[model samples]
Target: MENGNKRLAVLVGCNYPNTPHELNGCINDVLAMRDVLVKRFGFDHSHIELLTDAPGSLVMPTGANIKKALDQMLKKAEPGDVLFFQYSGHGTRIPSAKPGHPFRQDEAIVPCDFNLITDVDFRQLVNCLPKGASFTILSDSCHSGGLIDKEKEQIGPSSVTNDGTLQQSCSPKTIPFESILQHLTSQTNINTSDIGTHLLELFGADASHKFHLHPNELDLSESLKTDEGILLSGCQANETSADMNPMMTGGKAYGAFSNAVQMVLKDHLGSLSNKEVVLLARKSLEAGGFAQHPCLYCTDENADAPFLWQPQGSDL
Candidate 1:
């Protein structure tokens, strides 16, 4: 049975407080995105699930918690529904687990507790949505391009370097693979060279499904001609997103890409298409002297569809 079209969102921000991977702008990005969804997109505040790493937050943005929240939201979703997910945190790339995949590295998001959610997980989630529904993801983190596996890329990398190689000093939003491995080893005292083993031991079944994939299931030849996943990545898979601290923003911290998207939204009077939003955001970042380039991934039709399914002339 098709439920009436509803606006649903899952917003997550991880600061990784007091840790080596601590960020300064992620929580602020979530709060800001949430406000826009309610005020501009007409999303009911009650329908939005917010998870952050800030102190006193009721639900922390752990890997399991985030997956559970997204699962529940998708469960209630039906045809004509509009679903949105905003992630603000560090991003990383790891060698592909998929056998014979073209891309050497797969993109992933870092949760507050160091659990990573990979592109394969996102692709699975998007595949579960009903035919008429849309799931849009705004990832304000480094190495975020292609976060949705197999989705068509409307805007792609320009000068991205080889996979798994990132400029860390310029991109604080990127947490290196070595750093994550060291942290896990320190905590678990497991002397395995493979990071996947440590993640499996720490998170077990809750670990990223990429860790347990069978070699037979590694084919990437399937087409996404019928998929409805949209991704607004902060940068190319090999590039990094910038985190604007209080010192830089002169007040509240913010993910550079998140702030750019907000600025584009606020400046436009009517609803903008997905392609328009990403293009404007790219311009905004370039104007601000940020080297990061935001990219969009979705079907050709979705590239022209109104963002969040909001109609034309809808007020922002």
Candidate 2:
């Protein structure tokens, strides 16, 4: 399954951690995804990497580990390579400190140690990739939808569960670290400026005037922008994505959106377009009685175009 062109994947799931709402199934979900890509999509074992909390000789990825993984991928990736990054865990949004900041908040991926993987850092990483390469990122966790847009809708408070009790808490707010440090350091960089511009566009004129709060919304168009890439998120900014229930089977009970994606990959591999895949995933989730909606954000004009995973002799 090895292709001369380098194709690397970094699958990360942080379940056993110092965070609220511990997960029981995200690791299984990542493993399932690895299997799907390797067996069905012709990915080589050497080309793909899985970083999780699974027992029995598994490499766990942390803050430094994550940086190393990304660096390795970038080092080996060619122009045509396709890099896939899948994360299952928590996300947060903090408030920005600058008064005239365009964005009202900063978004981040919550690591195992409760440290933040800021979007500014992510943007720097993305920009470093070879021009012709493409990236596909799938995130299943709270506040992930905001990674793409400042005005991204926040998930309603009703969807989350705390201490076995269903709770209705809106998504958390985030401010860029640069904004926080600007006051202390009195210095700035291009990355900070870009983030500020995006934040302003999302929060609008009131970004600097006041702290405006809203429901979580995922901006697929802004996040998944690339001529050849796609971004698939578990839920909208305002929606809650569930952890696995031990009572369920098929690895671990997945978030409704992740579950639907697994179903599409399993049952309809080659017979659906990216849009169709998302539609089917949504239908499956609703049929299973999920209350929130799953979202598929992509910048590729052909995102809605037909794509099928057909087996030999299968009808297209």
Candidate 3:
């Protein structure tokens, strides 16, 4: 069943092997997602870009490489096309540099090389998408709930449990600010307290534009109102997603949220709505004793929209 519209995807998983921020299951998460896209959703294999930090990987999941892949996908996007981005890695929260920023903190995904891609970067990307195009992001990482800045919250802390209790047995996939500062300090030999300055020095022009913006110029109204982007975050902004190893799952290592989504999709016969998927996944996580709550950020219309386009529809 081929949908008339084109489908493209960028999948990134950073295991950060042998590093202080190492994880046991990111690579496996994205690989499983790749299969799901191709086999279940009819996404062409050639149109999908895969990036990882696994040994001998052709393209590393560095910040520069990830941005380039996303740009390429957007360039190839036409109205009515479907685009997807999946990140299974460590996500960090940095104190907002701009004075009086509403959120007070900026959420980011950690690349293999430690160059961070912040929420603003994703907002800009969503703004660039063609009018009739749709871009769905599945971020299976900690502090990922608001990764796409200012998107409407269809399902979030208000609708779910906001108790902020973390399961003691679960391994969280977040890199602390101190760890990031230490790593960047070692790399650039600069002991500055500001993460933005360290990012500017290390990546130069390639660093996130968020770090370079003047405080007074930080208006995101346009990016806030986008109808083309949908985000399914692994956990609430204040919660940590679990990294499940074989010892915990008695099988292959993987992200608890990622595995929960896969299970929901597999158990269903027809396509589930975006909101339905999150609700079901949240249930699965709760049943498994994991504390992280999956969230969906998108418009009300998208909340009812079928997850990524149905296998037999032209809506993509």
Candidate 4:
């Protein structure tokens, strides 16, 4: 069933344990996605891998497991291979352990065990790939956009103090900028520069305490000039993507973006480009009255190309 010219794809999803919410809510979506790729898109099932929270399977997304998977892919993947990485779960920012290091914070994807695959690990994985292999990463979780923040905005409102001095008011709803600065300053344990540098590269320079737009305008194709990578995030760095109850739709919960992706790939299989896919998905969500923006951040110059899957009779 292999298509000699088709690319490989690896999909991963996670739902945490012991939490009221399930971590693998989107596992089915990923499975469905893989099916579409294989049956309609010309991909070989052997070329597609799925990792999830299913029992007795590969341990759910530990840092080591992520690395192991990457290593496996690197070994088998060759130039011109189109690689896709999809993740659905929680995202966090942890304080760094040392001072003067690049990152004062660390970003992560929460695994089933509550451990994380830090951004540091991701960068290393990306850097290790062979040139000319294209990567399209889709992350459905909070802070996914941290991989692309560029501008800075004050998180809390500014107020006038008693002495007529403009000061930031401390309130339960307001996050103080100083708190973030202080957290960054308190590191004395682990070296965090590399993590910090990676954070800045992914989330932008002002990621400390300010919410900023993800630097999404980067020419994905240009950055990976060797024809290798692209990124499509669920939300901007400063925003949170919703994970709603799937049972409401006669199933379990799924992130809003995940649901939309399924809709497009299933309904409009042959006639849409990635850009059209994103637009339709966004419109569908908005028409349903969801107040979220399903954004598409692509580093791939050819991101506008037609989808890999298309119905018969479609022009190639």
Structure candidate 3, residue pairs in collision: none
Instruction: In angstroms, give how far residue 310 of model 2 lies from its true place.
Output: 9.1
User: How accurate locally is residue 162 in candidate 4, as Cα lDDT from 0 to 100?
Assistant: 21
Candidate 3 to truth, TM: 0.93
Looking at candidate 1, the ten consecutive residues that score lowest on lDDT are 161-170
lDDT of 2 by residue, 24-138 (tens): 6677778888877676655678877777765553566555566668778878888766777888776656665434554666556655544345554454456566766755667
TM-score of each: 0.92, 0.67, 0.93, 0.65
Better of 3 and 4 by TM-score: 3
Each candidate's clash count: 0, 38, 0, 19
Task: Put down candidate 3 lDDT per residue, 12-46, tens digits, no spaces.
Answer: 99888987678888999999999889888988999
Residues 27-145 of candidate 1: C-alpha lDDT, one tens digit per residue? 89999999998888888999999999899999999999999999999999989898999999999998787667646988999998888999988998998988788999999999999
Q: After superposition, how far is residue 33 of candidate 1 from its true place, in Å?
A: 1.0
lDDT of 3 at 66: 99
Q: Model 3's lDDT to the true fold?
A: 0.87
User: Which candidate leads in lDDT?
Assistant: 3
Q: What are the clashing pairs of model 1?
A: none
Residue-by-residue lDDT tens digits, candidate 4, 171-274: 01111223323333354333344334343433343223222222232112122323333445555444455666545346555666777787776786366765
